[model samples]
Target: MTVLLVDAANVVGSRPDGWWRDRAGATTRLLVRLAQLPERRLSGPDGGVVVCDGVVAVVEGKARDVPAPDGVRVERAGGSGDDALAACAARLAQEGTPLLVVTADRGLRARLPAGAAVAGPGWLLAALDETGCVPPA
Candidate 1:
């Protein structure tokens, strides 16, 4: 089984898609895309989790609520979003589960456990496209 930990903020902020000006829109698109991941069969065996640095909800400070796909969970970064992701990957590695971390940040990529697969924003965009999450031209 393979576990995927996503740096949702990085994925949302990656491309020159005007995400900064439309953070909510970008996040929606990213979340929608993430929701499609398993249906597209792109997620590995263990499933995926989308982690962000901000609060998960509009009213809740401790947790924000985001729509998670059938096999995905949306989580706030809390202490350290990236740190949590890295730790998840490390735990998976210890369990002999293949780990895949989705993000374009070079530093975060470097911190991943050995044997974890790395994919950048471009790759995620492509995957989303494959799943028909990216709007049609």
Candidate 2:
């Protein structure tokens, strides 16, 4: 079973579609989209199937209140989003669980636990589109 750790702020802010203007609203929309990930068959960077048993979206600042959905958990980062995500990855990795970190931030990617796969925002967006679980408008 694979567990996904998402940098919610990074993914939500990847596009310039006014996310900065309303961070909470944007994060809420992103959380709704993430709720559909579990049932969808997503493709990994290696062209293999990416199946997630659990999805954790780490948010900070104004976007910390997005509620969790089935198979998903909304985590509020006490400090930095990167640190929170990295910590989650480390904890999961220590348990020998397969992990995937979703974000396009290079620095964040570098900070993830070893053996964790990294996927960018575009990858997630494409998968969501393929599964017909498009992001809320």
Candidate 3:
């Protein structure tokens, strides 16, 4: 299955829509977008997990255990989310799961495996459109 590891902070900071001004607003928007993720067509399993610095406890679009109606999962990171993600990616890669790391941080990118796919926020937004990750409002 494709396990999408999302970097919440990086994504929020990547947009120039003034999301940084309001962390909650940015997080809500991102979660909504994540909830709209689409089914994978890559000839294998696919899923997405959003790593946030803090936990929201409950999210409007959350779908419990199962993948979101679309194909994403939202999660909160403990103290070191990025480190955890990199480590998870490495382990998942070893197990043969397609790991797509979404982040704009150059430093974090260096830690991913050499062959892992990395995309910035702009790229992710475009992908959302391409994958129809979000349904029509």
lDDT of each: 0.58, 0.82, 0.58
Q: Rank by lDDT, descending?
A: 2, 1, 3
How many backbone overlaps does candidate 1 show? 3
RMSD of each: 7.0, 1.4, 7.9
lDDT of 1 by residue, 30-92 (tens): 665565554244532234533322111111122234445444566655576677667766866
**lDDT by residue (tens digit), candidate 3, 10-117:** 776676887657666666666667665534442111234433221111222122222222334555444565776677667767988666677787888999988997
Itemize residue pairs with steric clashes in candidate 3. Answer: 1-45, 2-45, 2-46, 36-133
TM-score head-to-head 2 vs 3, winner: 2
> Each model's TM-score, in the order given?
0.69, 0.92, 0.66
The per-residue C-alpha lDDT of model 2 at residue 11 equals 85
Give a tens-digit lDDT track for model 2, residues 1-137: 67778898888888899988999988888788888877556777679998767788999988877676676787799888888888888988998888888899999888887768888888877777777876666
Which whole-number lDDT from 0 to 100 does residue 73 have in model 2? 85
Pick by TM-score: 1 or 3, better one? 1
* Candidate 3 Cα outliers beyond 4 Å, as residue runs: 40-70, 131-137
